[model samples]
Target: MIDKVIEIEPLDDLDFGKVTAELRSKRREQDTIVLFHPSDSCQENLHHFIAGAKKIHGSMFDYGVNWDDLIWDIRGFESTTSLKDLTHASNVLFTQDNGKGPKIKVSRKDEVPFAEPFATFAKAFVTHRHNEKPKSHSNHMVAIKALRLLYQELPNSLTPCVSQLLPEHFNKAISCAMGTQAKPTLYVTGVHLTAIAESLDEYRLTATPMTWKNPIPRNYKHGGASQNRGGKEAKKERAKQLPKTDLLLFLAALWGTYEEIEERDKALVCMSIILLLCGFRMDEFIGLDLNCIPSREEYDKLPLEIDPETGTLARILRIRVLAKKKGHWDEKIVPHCTVDTIYIAVERLKALSKPQRLTAQIMLEEGKWNRFLEFDDDDYLTSREVKEHLGFPGASATNTISTLALHGIQRDPSSLKRKTRFRVGDIHDGFCDRYRERISPIINGFGHDELIIPIWEFLTLRYLNQYTPKERLNVFAEPL
Candidate 1:
């Protein structure tokens, strides 16, 4: 209720060391997002948040919040604007207490870059934008960030109220932003600037100049269009790029005669073909279930494509994919032309990857090693049930022992046959540098012992084999 005041406990001076140490660097550590907890007691209740990366620009950066629970949501406040000063902000916001909208948020009091009129306007604008029913939290930050950057760029004397923001201010922001920001970010700023500029038209200050113009040129591209447009030219300029057309052609040609290639290497070719056909992102493809493909009856139910050569119906397979960019479960269907080619590759990959999938499913459900492979720290690999654990099919018994040997898995002379040949505990914990090459979720180019990592890295991660590609080459000595 507006009648009641809300109090947020700030962090103690103990964090003063963290602030001082952080600021002492030649440049601000922009990458770190500081978590300030006001109520040091309960973690489940997340109270406030800051885009804490941007500290108060001047001497005020030294301040710290209560070291316990960081609770900064904008809805609980008494008045949105006409605040006397930043520090004079009223404590009227709370997670549980009810009355909402446009309250003075003490959350970023120290973080504001300006004084009086402009500072109040910035905080009020951030709070108001945050409560806009249509926008998500991320978009709320975009609006707040664009406003802050504009305020920071503008000269100190100009304290243009929220209703008085001009196109010129936006232009200045974009011009300065371009120097520090990537084009994609510039595009987002330009969009919110246009929206904000247009909204100010209704409340334009008659005493000052106003032009509701957008900073981004009408022709400037945003989102996917800009990314894919002229991508080939962009590709040439990037430090790492796909190989030349000639090289790609050679690879495709090599894969064309894949039967002639080693069976162990075919998985890579299969993954490539599957990706090309399905258009799944690397993470999406790798996370697929063994039964990802629908049965023939299911495909038959989908809209049929007419064959070009013959007058008959062709089955279409609509694959459900985890569409990350879209932030939802989505579906994709391969082009009819490559249906048969892709089917074979996917089926082959399924059979090859089956063992890992089985063990991975159980690990996924249990969040740990399955019963067959689970053991005490002193347990030795004395069970024949390892077929339930290892990326079972690709590895042979001999290579399994060799890989185990690489991890310091040793035989106990009192051991039995193949089962007790190696110690069990080390296989999960051991890190072998020579074979540090990890499988890429998209195109798994690296293969040694049929993806049977001694540590079973993918199996170890309980996220259903959401393997990430290695960002850099391993410098460890090569294994023969």
Candidate 2:
């Protein structure tokens, strides 16, 4: 593998190819052997592993996809499966169908055994959840957090099993939950806990028995008088769940003011406009694919209609939106206008960043990020040169690019304390920015009326998307 990336090696005068060959000897003969990774403890950790599998991406991973055996270890231990592994990873990831999710922090401290009941129960509950269909990883994390919080509120003496949990324990945990999550979130957390508690007496994971009764109301949404008791302040908060008017008007003005903005900032302007148009969750935006929209031919197949009021050509473009975190589902949008606005913005944005996307494609295929397309690998470049290559010139650009290591090589092999030299191939974690074809402030384009762009597909194009009802989208959201 040609994977050794030198950070900075200066290029000086050389007359011909022969001259270059003449001085091709080692700059210093006192070199030592180095390994690719200095500190990873790999498969050697296999012995300490009790039994678990790496959470690999599944073939049956999408919405309506069949249950594949490889999707997870449904036996209920995949998330925290690395219990006894000797690898240096200090965290355990949440179980995910595709390979993206948050990780829970792990410690070798006493908390490990103390929290075992919660972790153990979480593994079972989540496994049971998968039996129906994969729950969103965000929801899974919330369930785990709920359990962890409940465990924390318990007395110091270690609870032997989940069945030992009591009513007072739940009350203390609900108090903690109220502080961190809203009523809806609290409700879901309560549901998961109740599910396990209800089943624990009969279907105990062990000989341990469950005697705890849930305090949370099953009718939480409408049980406002009983469950929602923060007095006037709580009522004020619930009344104001929608976004404030002044902030919203300021955002809406941005859509009309698009043409007046600077050319360099066109992409983000279009993005904010799309976000206003489509209520996307942040993760969904990042995982958007290039072919998110159907072909003109496919789109034409949808029932056609003309805009009678506008007296202009109108069509409902059935935009293909990727919900990366949430499983894909169909949504009905109302009176979304102007295919011209969305189609043009998407195409133009795609055009601008096509080069970066192609480069990313190469990076993905080769599993390497060694060199820029036109730059010499042996030549050294400064931060200024790199900044210029990326386009954009100013104090702000210099300030940002100056801090980049940009694939620079360090002087000391044993220590990262040494200064780094910049090279053309020194791109940072640029490849990790998903669904983006172009790089910059993303891409430049204009939008109008409505366009539901995915959050991640085009760094230029992504936005957090959800199956928002048309009414709430018009009302806007409260300050996040």
- Winning model by lDDT: 1
| Model 1 lDDT per residue over 250-321, tens place | 768867898898755667777676776677776556545444567656666777677554546776566655
Clashes of 2: 26
TM-score (C-alpha, index-matched) for candidate 1: 0.43
Q: What is the C-alpha lDDT of each candidate?
A: 0.45, 0.43
What would the per-residue lDDT of candidate 2 be over residues 239-306, giving only the tens digit for each residue? 68856788678766765676776654566655555454555554433333456566667777777566
Q: After superposition, how far is residue 162 of candidate 2 from its true place, in Å?
A: 3.3
Per-candidate TM equals: 0.43, 0.49
Candidate 1: C-alpha RMSD after superposition: 19.1
Model 1 residue runs over 4 Å out of place are 1-145, 154-168, 178-185, 196-211, 223-248, 254-268, 278-288, 296-312, 322-330, 351-360, 370-480
